[model samples]
Target: MPHGKPGQAGSFTLGPASGDVNTAYRYRLTSGSFDSGWSAYKPGATATIAPVPPTSGTMVLFAEAKDNYAAGAANSVEFVVKEGDGPVARWNFAETSGAALDTSTTDQSLRDNAALAGGAVRTDRGRRGEVTVTRATETTPAVKSTDSGLKLNGTTDYAVTSGPVIDTRASYTVAAWVRMDVPTRNATVFGQKGVNRSPFYLGYEHTSKKWSFREVNTDAAVGTPFSYQRVESKRPAVPMVWTHLAGVFDAVNNTISLYVNGELQGTTPFTTAWAATGPLQIGRVHWSSVYSDYFPGVIDEAAVWQEALTDTQVAEESELIDAHAVPSVELVTAWTPAGAQGTTLRDTVSGYGSDLALSSGASLADDELVLNGTTGAGTTAGPVVDDSGSFTVTTQAVVDAAKILSKPDGYKAQILGQRTATGSSWSLWFEKTGTRQEPELDENGDRIVDENGNPRTTPVPVGRWHFGRLTADGTGASVESMEEALMDTETRLTGVYNARHRTIQLYLTSDQQASDGIAYTAQVGTGELAVGKGYLGSWANFLPGRLSDIRLWAGALSDSKQVSDVVGT
Candidate 1:
């Protein structure tokens, strides 16, 4: 008898011919031969094995053969398990030629069928597999100004129905892009009212040529007022040009920062405490139940962030917006030489000389003068000089004579002199008597004469000198001169004269009335008056020269030191 192994899934034959000796064969899926179990089939019979389910690990297959003989008589036959006769093992394509096999026959067959149908087999390898998906919420879409709000004929304006509210208790940064088809004239861009009924807002006025930030407090019956700050950019407001505007409010820090075209223009502090209000209004503000200061421009992409943006981020945003719009002005300019002196001191002839002399360290090439500290001891040379106490010029000849003053034209005169028995002590002097003074032509044009017809004469002290000063305090010309002496009996001089001349001049007694003996000629030099006055301030001399770097304030200097420091002689 012959026996076959189970589950081998292949045919086996075990029969002997009539002339051949009797033989038997057996086959089995032995543990060593077919560890992964197999099914057997009869000779000339077809059998199929179902596809194995996908498994993670490994698979193996084997088959065995044996010879059997009857009990009464011994029988033998050679038997063998051929390679194709055993169960077929599977493996991956990558491992098929190596240690493992492709056990997924169904997949392999499907790929083969696809290829036969003229389709390529695609293995989605190295791709991100199966990801969880999410859907976005519907945001309130913002309309571009160019699309909706910008098409109006002139001064088109719009308000946002829904936007983030600014909280006074917290800090915030607001930014926007704007292009005015017509000038804004004077209007507000953004604003909010505080709980204290105060109005704080940012606005631009074309007529005034200013961009202003106003914080108005309505606390007192008369409304106690204060100016937190205001700033104006150098560029003029131009039509059809986009400008970037930004404002940052840090209530806790009490600071307000303003930015134009991504650059910080100004910063100030909030003097009064901030009061709470809901949302800030954009494009308009209500004052006394009227919508005033309406913005007239195309405002697009307005944003309000809780945090202040860094300078780099602001610049990046500016660049991004500029790419889409034309800027109103050139961002930078090449260096060029100026035509005349950069600054002019108006009153160069006044005895109260500001240190407007040029310093050695200064240069026309760079157009800069270094002030403050320099090596020279007395009145270091510069374009400006401050004065201390009073300045005076005594001799009527110095005033009445033709003194070619070195000063900017169109300046006024101030003369300080005195008339007394012990030599005129000190008295304020001005151009009292002179013809052709209105259209003051030159240094030689001024003269002093007595209306008393006493032959304008010099007082008793011929050698005494008085003080006078010409000042250009960033305004029109002014002359200040005075002479004071506590002991002398004051003489009321009948005639005094001054001139607004371009060149400072020295005079001789011959230039005065023949009766006066006082000599007007420069004591130290031929054409220069020694600028020194004892007990008054530093004494020095200034000849006719260029004067520059002049400043004048409406109010007097804040401190005595400031005046002394500026006019250190």
Candidate 2:
């Protein structure tokens, strides 16, 4: 849009999209009824509307691409005519020096007064912003800003707003880009402090293991059971990824909604709402006469609005992270050069000081470790393996059938695992020649009879590959793929624990797909991660093979191409 002085006739150009894409445009007053129906989509075409943008109040310019398919999410820019500018307060954390400035409004009172405590430091790794509010008070059009965010160190790190930003008793909306590093406990993205319980909170709820929006019905420190009402997302929150969360309190509708990414996840009806007054705490919650649930992650573009943002408004904000952007990933460790640091296998990822100590019983050659079924193994030497909820482990190895040491039932060979005295956090191994119990069948599929008239039975051979995992709640299960292609061949095996889906996937070589992954979750055990062997009770299930490479990622590598690339087709 071309802008001149506010009073001059307004002239806006709907230019052809880049890459010669076809685009359409429309405009309407956010609070008024002047609507320009979507213009015809055409490449290199221009469209003009007789009505100019509102000289006051608010106007929205909506644009959508019309190529072979929708190129991206519809983008709408809000141009508002306001006194001080747009949001009540905005913390971009983009400052190179001095306190981070609040750029949305000019009111000195509403400026950035949040204090960074503990290890909360400004970081350049933040979301790719896609929306920015343009106010008529500005001399130029608004441009989206992609800037740094505050990294909260989970234990004591946080940003405390000097004072409350919005009236919690009334309808309001609050949002931020949150990248959770871990979900060991309930974590807060933003929480309004009060005498006791905060009036509203948006973050991961420990009970449900889901992103949640919490609102209390009373302002008093002591409240009835009905005072606490929360709406949790249908999907569990996956750690080590950046996500946009918006908590909307609609006093008019008597409902509270939580939006994940950009879409409304779930809404809960409330009987009443109360105001919480005090400083707004980012990355921590105060309640029960003590501060707790300090967030272990990063927060960016934290803002508050006095009004309940409509669905369109929320969707527009969701666009901050492009609809097509590849999901963000946090690499916890990558143990490369398997034998890089002399006798110890050094983790090549900088800042992550994980090294694997190959047992003296094992021999390293050509960056590969050869483990005998009885005497060889390698274990994580540093403080690794604490990523409990979601993780991926990929390895390339060849299992020698002879080393299976097949007992009467079968043999087990551990490829990777983190096990402690109490239970196994996760384990992947090959259960070779195990038998499946079933009724014996005669030629016609009928159960065969035994001498005493009891049904005859036979043991059926179960396939080799199996993955085992335990949830934080103590439940555990192991799933085996019945493909029967025993572990004798060199293959890439990728095990993924996606806490979001509550499932575990074992991916074999790219040429084939293991049916569906067995469902599983993660629990961090006290033991360090070990390759070639995992403990069941007495450090058993040793692998006798060449383990060429093994790498662990914090996020799930579920995408087909992602698996193929990481594991090699």
Candidate 3:
């Protein structure tokens, strides 16, 4: 037996009608004691069972055939019925023959009038135009993905109806998965639009390349193309990509909102009283006006709800449409200073064995790891060799003059740096030289020449916290700093190096100061990654501040969104 929802009419077919051409068939159904007597015998044909009342459990249907040739055997099949509040009409286009099946009990099946124009061809769950029509006809385009969708020809293609299939007085949601075949022109994706009445329209405008929503109402001013309230997405929609577009009209909040890929794009006030009195049309505003704005794209999984959907519901439906829209990034490492002394700060993403060792003078205090500036106070780990050439390192540090982190460099050194100047290096410190305070720079903005002709650097102030980040890309190395004199104690710093984009970004959380797009040459080094103290003060010097929440990413966080996602915390 075929599957059906409760309160829906059941349909059954027994094909390969064999033997005598004059054969006849009889059908009956039974559920417990309730039974329908065998129907009068007739020519071999499929049966359209009457709509059964909402039911549960199982119903048995039997069929037997007979004719002037001979008597045929009997066969039976059982059907399981389910009860629920489902869609008014759901056309998955899974039918192989006949009109598109209405999967809902309400039986709002789309009226298929293929004979009036070019017929539609069905393949798998998708339907498309088999021939070009002189008159307007509905055309479903082929979708490249798994789920089937409908395609429109921008002009002279649309689905029209004599009456509205959906009615809404207060709240409603209309959503669909759409992909634009032509992005240079404006077009309507779906609506019940006529010259004067429409509940809503979800479409795109070529001028701004943005998804827009419009709900018909006479109260709105007449100067606009749409008399109803309108809201366009803040972010423009990209062409040729599958996007889930939805519009929610909420009378309770007097707001009409637009959403793309489940993210709320924009909301506008919609206080005018409204009702859709015209017929529904898909792909175009109407069949009579096919020359007007018509959608030129593939549309699928369209749904209309009488109630405004929540964000979570919209998100869930978007997932059912496509899961590849937002890609996931892999994290490399995460470290916190809240653990006990000598506890290992493990790498969260991969290679946990490369954990940092919490050692000497590095004591856990006030929920942070304090480095004594003298002796060995910090964490150390073996080398982290990355071939990707892209990396993001973030740390929250509380320092006072001493080195914050070092690779293998020795004494008289700044906070973060490699042994040689040619290697990727970074530093954050107060004093450049405690004993012999160096001048900051010469008149040419170059380091002052020392007695030996080597450039002499200046020393920053001491006794306060400072944030600094330095990154190297293909062009060169760039540095950003938040000086102690300008910021309060402690600060969060994020450094990102993206070789592909040839950009570096630094975020100073203390003041929310972001130094973005600092042109820098890219450099890929083979040195292992390390934290805190380098060579002894007799060598390089240990960090003299606290460090907390150290994290590393393998890929370049090239965008502001990626940067905010990481540094926001």
Best by TM-score: 2
Q: State in Å the error of residue 354, model 2.
A: 3.2
Question: What C-alpha lDDT values do all the predictions have?
Answer: 0.32, 0.67, 0.52
Q: Model 3, range 1-569, lDDT digits (tens) per residue?
A: 33554435567765325653434556666633224444433555544456352344577766666556665667788777654233444444444454444454443454321111123333322221111122223686433322244556676665554566566566777777665664657788767644554556788877777889877665233354445677887656654435667888877788888877666777888777466556556666532333356777666556666656655456555544222222222244666666544556555533233466666665666767676666544444322323223456677766554242322222222344322133333333333312225566867876677789877764433332222222222222444454432312566666665443345666666233345556544432323344565432123445666677776644445455545644565
For candidate 1, lDDT tens digit of each residue in 1-569? 22222212333343333433332223233223323343333422333332221111222222222223331222332333221111122111122122222232446432211000111111111011111122223764322211111211223333432222455445556665554445545666666544333345665766666555555434222344444455554444433334566776656566677766566667777645454353355565555544456665444435555444444344444432222231111111011113325332123432223332233422223332222212111121211101111111222212212221222233222222211122112222223222222232336754445577433433221112222222223221222223321112222211111110111211111122123212221111111111111111221122111112222211121122322322221
Task: Point to the candidate with the largest lDDT.
Answer: 2
Clashes of 1: 65
* Model 3 per-residue lDDT at 535: 31
Q: Is candidate 1 or candidate 3 better by lDDT?
A: 3
Judging by lDDT, tell me the better candidate of 1 and 2. 2
Query: How well does candidate 1 match the true structure in TM-score terms?
Result: 0.29
TM-score-better candidate, 2 vs 3: 2
